[model samples]
Each structure stands twice: as structure tokens, then as C-alpha cells.
Target: MTVLVINSGSSSIKYQLVDPESGEAIAVGLVEQIGESTSRVKHTYDGEKHEYEQRLADHGEGLRFVLDLFDSVGPSLAEAGIVAVGHRVVQGGDNFNGPALITEDVRDLIEELAPLAPLHNPANLRGIDVARELLDVPHVVVFDTAFFQTLPEEAARYALNREVADRYGVRRYGAHGTSHQYVSHKASEWIGREDLKQIVLHLGNGASVSAVVNGEAVDTSMGLTPLEGLVMGTRTGDIDPAVIFHLSRVAGMSIDELDDLFNKKSGVKGLAGENDMRAVWDMADSGDENAREALDIYVHRLVKYIGSYAAVMGGLDVIAFTAGIGENDDRLRAEVLERLAPFGVKIDPEVNAVRGDNIRAITTADSSVTVLVIPTNEELAIARQTMDVVATLS
Candidate 1:
């Protein structure tokens, strides 16, 4: 059976029809700039690409265009044998532990939890609502927070008043559960060991790190929201919680103002006015001192987490890099592993420089820790989990 993976963002939708058992995407498409004056649809299949432009007034219209393309192009949904839709829900919070078949009750619960993931859950539910109404397929809600359910309480809690935390549902509920889970397992398979301690650095426009033992998530970087992890392209990661007070008390910043500042204006963008790592590197190379400082700050946070998580997990066996920067950026990889040389971590410079879509090791055979570049496939992970959830239901 085929599974449809839908990752709907605030203004975009990414979808794929996949045969999870064989790990192949029978069809894939993206709807970007939704609700904009002019939106673009990029669809791919059978080694060919097609693009369309139209006014996608909302998620419903955007998804309709996607279905239209499938029908007009090749390998229609019926031919793909689509059985279930795997919707990527970002914040499952305290309620979910795995993929859930969508129901009226689940939909209401997701809407209720929107405040916990203000930027993600609403968009996620929007896609689910549309697909349910349009497609005659069972839907599975694959949560990004589901994998981190295995995180021990000590690792998942914040040092706040227990009563207030309980009342407000405040805690370290890590994001990027799908990508982290995908790469960690692939990392183990590459090393030919399932029980090795691993650290997965998912460095994209949004970044997070995960410390995994065997196949389970023991600890992760993101907490409560995606905004709490490492210094990302636009969000401040770990900061003094008291800073919010200072900004309000002294700077006269409101909660709304602070939210926009940290979530949209801070991080590398706040420092150097550039968030793309590639552009930031160029600026730094051109003697932009602020960009240089931003780079220092970004790597400092990553290196610190690597050591802390390694200590937490006793020792690190495989240090896997996934996502955009993690997979392709050779410079950042070298910078991070170089600092860990004292821990007997070694990278084959030649291997580290090579790039591809496949899993490969950058560390030498003699290195104490195996450093790998594992490409992350979140859609596939969601499809498998979605299939698993729907299978149980059937």
C-alpha cells in the first residue's frame, strides 16, 4: 500500500506518495507561497519535473491543485494505491506517543494544543482538515514530538515551579523528532551496530541535536518549542530566561514584541543580518566582523551540546550529521569535530569533503568516535510510522 506524506507549513505544503516498505517515492510535489498573489506548484515523477503557477487562496485550493496535477500527470493516486495520509504534526506535547489515526476528537485536541506550537499545529491541522474532506483515504497524524516521548523526566523537565509548570504545560518537549529518529537509525546501520551511543546534529535553516542510545531518544536540544534549541537561522536557542524580564523591565518590550524578536529577528540574523550559513560565511570571509562573531557563537553552542550530551550518554560512538548544513557544509563539520579531537574523534579530511545523498562516514577507521553524514528523510519516516499506526487500526 502507498502512503501520502503531507507536511503543511504556515504558507506551504509538501507532499509525497511513497511505498514505505520499499522506501520509494512514487510521486512528490510542493505547493509554496500559498495564499499569495501568485503561488507555484512543483511536481515530480518518472524522472521528469513540472511547474505550475496559480493563485492558491488557501490550503484547500493549494491541495486541490496538487490532486489536479496528480490526475493530469501520470501515476494517479489510484495507481499509486494510496491507503493512508501521514500528516506531520510538529507539537504533540504530553498527549501523543506515536502516530494517531485522525478523528474528530484528535482534531479538536490538536486545535486545543495550538498555543503550545503556535507556528506549527494550526498549519498541520489545516492540511489534515483539507485532505480529510477531499481525499478518500485514512489519515495518520505523525508527530515530530512523538519520538522524544522516551526522554526521561529529568531531561524533559525545566527548573520551574512544579505547580505552575503543570498548570501551564511547560517543559522540554523537543522538536525535529522525525528527522532525528530517521538519521540516528541510519547512523547505526552504517556502523553495523544498533546499540551505539549517537549524537545527531540536524543542522538546517532550523537546527537541533539529539543524543540517542540504541534506537531511542534519550535527550534532545529543542525544548517546549522549536525556538528553544540551538541558535537557529532566526530563533535564539539557549538564552538566560531572565533576559526576557530585563527586556521588559528595562527595554520596555512587550511579550508580543519579545516573541517576534526572539522567534523572527534574533540568532544569526539578529547579529549579522544574514541567516543563511552560506551567505554568513561569505560575509565573514569578506571581513564582516559581526558575521565572524555569529559563526563563533553558532559553533560554540553546537560544540558545547556535543560534549554535554556525550557526558550524559557516557560516551559517543557515532556523531551523525543530517539536514542541509549537516550534510553539505564541509566547513562547519570540520570546525565541530576539530574541537573534539582531544576525545579521540578524528575525521578523514578527504572523506569529509565529499558530499552525496547517501550515508557515508567522514571519520577514519581508527577514530574513537565514528562521524557520519547521514541524509535525513523525514517523509519516509512519517510514512513508515503512519503505515504502522494505520496497520494497527486495521
Candidate 2:
């Protein structure tokens, strides 16, 4: 049996038909620029790619077109044995601790929580509504924030006024919890220990770190929204709250403009004038001072978090790096771990330099902490969760 995983954004839908038992994505596709004059659709199956363009009015039309592609192309869904459709919802608030079957009530709850994730939940709900209408399969919602529901009170709450915070639903609801949970569990399985204290750095265009103990999340970087946490590609992570007030007063910047600045024009792009890590690295190698400083700032924030989490967890037994930069950037990994030399972390340069898809240790065998590079598969995680939720109905 297969599960169809859907990660819908404000303007695009990314999908994968997956075999949960074998962990293979049978087909993968994306529909971009929905509700545009010309929307692009790309589908790949059997090692071949098919691309097309059409004028789509909305998500429903875009999805219908995708269904047509599935029918016209090979591996028809009717024959593919699709058991469930997993929708990736960004914010679950404190309402859901795990994947939930999409009932009318659940769908309404997702809609209710839209204020918390203004950009993601509505689109996710759109995909869910359309897919449910068209597919006639059991649908499941896998939340990015669900895995972080286990965070302790101290980690989840902000220092602001409790009344206002509650009224505004302001708290540390982290993004990338799915990735952190998946990688942390894989790290525990790989290390053969369930009680290990671990830190997972999900470094990508969007970066976040989490502290896990015994396979449960204790603390995470992102708070209130994804705008908090480690330095990101375009976000001003961990910025001073007073900066907003100062900008409003001195610069006369409206909230919307300030939001645009911090969320879109800041971070690596703000510092180095380039958001892509590879471009930043090229500039740094060419002795561009701004790019070099951006790299330093990024690594500095990482080191700081690692030290803080080590203290919070009492001690650290494992450190797992996943996601794009975490998995591929050997140089950044080396720099981050090397800064932790005082903690008895010793990474084997040879092992760290080797690039592969499988989980492997980058630390020396005798090192105090077992450092690993585990590739995160969020799609497979969602698929398995979807299957689990569907199985409960039977």
C-alpha cells in the first residue's frame, strides 16, 4: 500500500506517492504558481519527467489537473493502492499531540488555528479539502508542531504577561518539529539507546535546533512563530523585541513593512546579500568580508545554542545534524563541532568529509558525544504517521 503526502504552501503543492513499508517515493510532483495566469506542473515517474503549463484559477483546479496527470501518466492511483492522503499542517497549537484523522471537526480546528500560522494552515486546509473531495480516501493531518507538544512548561511559555500571551496564543510553538522528531528517533535507534540526551540541528534555508531526551523533545529554538530560533535564510531569528519598537519610532516603519524586512529581507541575505549557502560560501572564499562575517554569525549562533542545550539536558550524549545544510555542509559541521572541543567532542575529519545518504557517525569512536549525520525524510515520516492514523480506524 502507498500513502500520498501533500505539503501545501501558500501558492504551491508538493506531493509524493510513497510506499511506507519500503520507504520509497513511487512518484513525486509539484504544482506551482497556482491561481496565476500560467501555472507550471511537473511530474516525475519511472525515472522520467513530464512538464506542462496551464491557467489554473485556484487550488481545486490545480489539484484536478494533477489528478489528470496521474491518470494520463503511468502508475495510476487506482492501481497504486493508496491507503491515505497525509496533509502537512504547520500549526497544531496545543490541540494535537500527534497525527489526527481529518474529520469535519478536525478540519474546522485547523481553520480555527489559522491565525497562528497565517501563511500555511489555510493553504494546507485547501489541499486537504480538495484532496478529500477528489480522492475518496482516509485523510490524515500531520502537523509540523505536533512533535513539540511534549515540551515542558518552561520551554513552551514566554516571559510576557500570561493574560496577553494566552489571549494572543503567544508561546514557543516550534517549526520543524517533524524533522527534529524524526532525526532524533533515528539517532536514538542508531545509537542503540532510548535514554540518550540529544540535540538535533535541522539546518537548511530555515534552521532550528531541538533538545531531546529519551526521544522526547525538551526544548526547541523557534518560538511563537518560525521567525524565532537560529539564524535562517531570510529571517531575523532571536532578535530583540525592542528593535521593533525602535524601528517604529525612529525609522517610522509600519508593522507590515517591519515584518517584511525581518521575515524576508534579513538573516543571511541581509548580512551577505545572498541567502543561498553555496553563494555565501563562494563569496566567503573570495575574501568578501560581509560573507565571512555572515558565516561567523551563523556558526556563532549554532555554537551558543549547542552549549546552552548541553547545559539544559544536564549533558549531551549525541548530536545529530539533518536537513540540507546540516547533512551536506561538511565544513560548517566541522566548524560547529570543533568549537565544542572543550566538551570533549572530536569529529573525525575524514568521516565528516564523506558524503552519503545513510546515517553515519562523524565523531571519533572515542569521543564523548556520538555525532551523526542523519538524512531526514519528512515525507516518509508523514506517510508512516498517516498509515498509523488510518490503521486505527480499521
Candidate 3:
């Protein structure tokens, strides 16, 4: 069966068409700079890339452009056997633990939870509405928070007034559930032990750290929103909420202004003036002091999470790094491992040099915790879950 996964953001839409039987992406693409005059799309299929420029004022237009792309330059949906449309929903609240067949009630609930994921849920719902209108297919909403639903109440709850907390739905809702879920299974397979404890550090443009015990997510760093996790490409992770009020009252910034600032103007970009780690590394290599400090802060933040998660899980058996920075940047892997020395984590420098989908143990033989690099495939995880959900419904 084929499933088309749509991940819609404010100004962009990412899509993948996959065949679940072999777990291969038949096609993938993104529509960028929506609402801009020179909006563009880059779609790839059968090892060929097709690029086009057009004005896409909204998610509906963006998705239509995608379907038209496949119709013009690639295989038709019928030919691809696209049996289902799986959406990347950002928040499921406490109600959804798995992918749900999109329905009027589900859509209403997703709309109600929009405030929790202001940057994502609305856009996701827009794409959902467009896809449902444009295609005659079974639609499913695969939530990014669903995997962390397994987190125990002790880990998921916040220490606040019970009545207020319950009324406000105040709790940790971890992000990157698809990536964490995929890598945890891969880690279990790699070590040949399903009953092992693993720490998954999904480092990328957006990052999160998750603790998986015996194939289930126990705790994750991202809480309430993607902004509440490890330092990321742009978002300032784990800041005091008072900072928001202070910026609003003292700096005279609106909530929208503050939200846009922290979510888009901060993180490694605000710190080093560049979000790309490669550029940051290059500047640091040339003895740029600010770049050096930015790199240190980034790695330091990651190590603290690793240490904290280790404490949470009692001890770490395996540490697996995935996502963009984790799998491709050896410098990051090296720096993270070096800082985690106190935890008895050691990486074999030679073994860590390889990159991109090549899984290998980076840990020294005598290290107490095994360190590994695993590439993340979130769409495949979505496809698998979509299939599982469809099977149960069947």
C-alpha cells in the first residue's frame, strides 16, 4: 500500500509518497516560501529532481501544485497505489495515543488544541482540509506527540496547582515522536536486545532527546511544544516563561512578536549569527571567538540533557544519535562524546568518521555506554503506523 505523508508548516509544506510493503519513498518534495511572489517547489521522483517556480498563497494551492507536479513530471497517484493520506499532526493532547482516521470529530479536537501548537496545528489542519477535498482517499492523522504518550505521569506532569493544571491541560507533550519511534526500534535491532535501555538524541534543525526503556518512550526533552527542547536551529529551547511576560511588558513586544522572535530569530542563529552548524564550525575553525562560544553552548546544552536523561533512566545502556547534525556531523558527534566522558561514554575517533545511514558503534570497547549514530526516517515510521492503523480498521 502507498501512503502520502504531508507535513505543513507556516510557510512551507513537506511531503513524501511511500510504499509500505518495501518501505521506500516513491517521491518526496517541498513547497517553499508560500505567500511569496517567487514561491518554488522541488520534487524528486525516480532519482530525478523537478523544480518549478509559482505563487502559492496558501496550503491548498501548495498541495495542488504538488499533485500537479506528480501528474505532470512523475507517476500518477493511481499508478503509485496511494491508498491513504497520512498527515503529520503536531499535537494530540491527552486523547490520541495513535494515528486516528481523520473525521469531523478528530478535526474539531485538533482545531481546539491549536493554541498548544500555534506554529503547527493550524497549518496541518489546513493541509488536511485541502487533501480531503482534493483526494478521494483514506486520511489518517499521525501525531508527532503520540509516541511519547507512553511517558509515565511522573515524567509527563508539571508541578502546579492540580485544578489549574487540569483545567489548562498543562503537561509535557514531546515532539519528534516519529523520529524517536523509528530510531528506538532501529537501536533495539542494532544491539540485538529488545529489553535494553537507550537514550535517543535526535539532533537537527529542531532537536529533542528521548529516553526509551524496553522499546517504549519513557521521557523526552521537548515539552508542550517544539520550542521547549534542546537548543535548535532557531528556537530558544527551555527558556523561563517569565521571559515572555518580561519581553511583553518591559520591551513592549506583542505576544506574536515575541513568539516569532524566539521561534524564528533565536537559537544557534541568534547566538552565532548562523544556524547551519557547518558555517558555525567553519567560523570557529578560523578562530572566531563568538562562533567557538556558540558551538560550546550548543554542545553543552546537549550534554546536560544526556546527563539528565541518564539520571532519569537510572543509567544509560546505549546512546544513539540521529537526525541531521547527529548522523552527518562528526564534529558534533565528537564534541558531544567528549563532553559525556564523565558518564563513561567514549567514541572511537576512527569509527566515528563515517557518515550517512551507515550504522556503527562509535564507543570504545571498554566504555560503559554504547554510542551509535543512526539515520532518522520519520516518513517510514509514519507509513508503518498508517499501515498498522489501516490494518486494524480493516
Candidate 4:
């Protein structure tokens, strides 16, 4: 069966049409700058790619554009017969610990939780509504936070007034659950152990680390939002949040401006004036002191978390790296493994050189823990969840 997965962001919509039976993507692309006059879409299928620029007043219009492209590109929309439409919903709150069918009640619940993910939930709802109108197929909402619902209460709760936190929904709701969950399951299989203790380092444009015990998320770095975690491409992760108040009192900046800076202007971006790690590494290699410092801070935080997770899990059996930076950057992996030597982690330089979408063991055979580079597949995870939803309905 085929499934269509949609991940809607504030100004972009990424979509993938997958044949889950074969575990291959039939078509995938992104429509960016929605609500902007210069909006554009780039789509690819069967080795062919096409780009288009036009106005997209909102997600509804952008999704319509996607439908037209699917028809014009190659596949007959009917023949593709998307059995389900899965969304990458950012927050599901305590009520939804798993994927759920999109009903009016579900939509209302999502709306109520929007403040927790203001930059994401509204856009996600827009995609859901638009997809529902265009396709009379099953629609499922797979939350990014749902995967971490397994976090122990001690790990999930904050040290605050219980009544106040519950009233305001101000508790830890880890992000990157989808990526962490995917990598953990894949790591378990790679390690050939069903009950595995694993640490998943999902380093990328936006970074987070997770500790999974026996396929359940025990603890994760990100809290409430993606803004809390290891240093990211453009986010200041795990900072004294009082810095927001300090910025307001000292610089007289508004809350929106502070949010913009911390969520979009900080991290390695603020330090080196760039977010792409490749660019930062190149500058660092050429004697850019600030860029070099950014790299150091990024890797240092990752190592710190790995060590913390090792302690949390009593001992880690496997460590998996995934996402854009983690799976491809051999040097970064080498450095992280070097720091994890206390845990007997070692990367064979030859094994690290191999790169692709496949999973591979990067550590030497004798290491205490198996180190792996497993590419994350969030879209496929959404698709599988969507398939499950459809099966239930049928």
C-alpha cells in the first residue's frame, strides 16, 4: 500500500509518497515560503526533479500545488491510491501518546495545545485540513512527542509546583521523538539484542540526544520544545532561560524578539555566523577561531550528554548517530567516539568512511558498546503509523 506523509512547518511543507510494502519513496519534495509571494516547490520522482516558483497564500494553496505536481510529474494520483495521509504533528500533549485519527475533537485538542508549539501546530492543522479536502482517504496524526511518552515521570517532570505546571502544561515534552525512536529501534536490531539500552544522538540542523531503555524513551535532552537540547544549527539549547528576562531588562527587546533570537538566531549560527556545519568546519580549518570554538562547543555538549545518558542507563549497550550531520560527518563521529573512550567506544576509520542510507557498525568489534551510523527515516515512521491507523479503520 502507499502512504503520503506530510510534515508542515511555519513556512514550509515537506511531503513524501512511499510504497511501504517495498520500503521505498515513490516521490518526495518540499514547498517552501508558503504565504509569501515568491513561494516555490521542488519535487523529485524516479530520478527526475522539477522546481516551480509561485505565490502560495497558505498551506491549503501549497498542498494544492503538491497535488498538481503529483499528477503532472509521473504517477497517476488514483493509481498511487494513497491509503492514508500521515502528518508529523509536533505536539500531542499527555492525552495522545500515539498516533490518532483526525476528527473534529482531535483537531480541537491540537488547537488547545498550539501555544506549546506555536511555530508548528497551526501549520500542521492547515496541512491536515487541506489534505482531508483533497483526498477522501484515512488521515492520521503522528506526533513527534508521542514517541517519548515512555519517559519516566522523574525524567518527564520539572521541579515546579505540580498544580501550576499541570494548569499551564509546563512540563518536559521532548522533541525529536520521531528521530530518536527510529534510531533506537534500528539500533536494537543492529546490535542483535531485543532488550537493548541505547543512546541516540540525533545531531543535525536541530540537535537532540535521547536515552532509550528497552525500546522506550527514558530521557531526552530537548524539553517542552526543540529549543532545549544540544547546540543546534540556529538554536541556543539548554541555556539559563532567565537570559530571556535579562535580555528584556538590559536590551529592552520584546518576547517575540527573544524567541526569534534563541530559536532562530543563536546556537552555532550566532557563534560562527553560519548554521551549516560544513561551512563552519571549512572556516575552522582555515583558522577561523570563532568557527573552531563553535565546533568545540557543539561536540563537547554531545559528549557530555552521551556520558550523562551512560550514567542514566546504568550502562549503555549501543550508541547510534543519525540525521544530516550525524550520519555523514565522519570527523564529528570520530571526535564523539574518542571522547566516549571511557565507555570503550572506538570507531574504525575505514568503517567510518563508508556512507549511504544503510546502517553500519562504526566501532571496532571489541568495543564495549556498538557504535552505529543509522540514517533516520521520519517519513517512513509516519507512513507506518498511518498504515496502522488505516488498518484499524478498515
If both were scored by TM-score, which would come out higher, candidate 2 or candidate 4? 2
lDDT per residue (tens digit) for residues 1-394 in model 2: 9999999888899999999999999999999999889999999999999999988888899889888888999579989999999999999999999999999999999999998888789999999999999999999999999989999999999989999999988998998988998999999888888999999999999999999999899999998889898999999899999999999999999999998999999999999999999999999999999999999999999999999999999999999999999999999999999999888999999989999999999999889999999999999999999999999899
Clashing pairs in 4: none
Clash pairs, model 3 backbone: none
Order of the predicted models by TM-score, top scorer first: 2, 1, 4, 3
lDDT of 3 at 254: 93
Model 2, 216: alpha-carbon shift in Å?
A: 0.5
The candidate 4 region of ten consecutive residues with least summed lDDT is 74-83
Candidate 3, 69: how far from true, in Å?
A: 2.2
Q: Which regions of candidate 1 deviate over 4 angstroms?
A: none
Which candidate's lDDT is highest?
Answer: 2
TM-scores for all candidates: the values are 0.98, 0.98, 0.96, 0.97
Candidate 3, residues 331-382: lDDT per residue as tens digits? 8889988887876777899889976566789988999999888888889888
Clash pairs, candidate 1, are 173-224
Model 1, residue 71: what's the lDDT? 90
**Tens-place lDDT digits, model 1, residues 44-153:** 99989999998999999999989988899966889888898999999888899888989999999899989999999999999999999999878989888988999999
Q: Please list the residue runs of candidate 2 whose C-alpha ends up more than 4 Å from where it truly belongs after superposition.
A: none
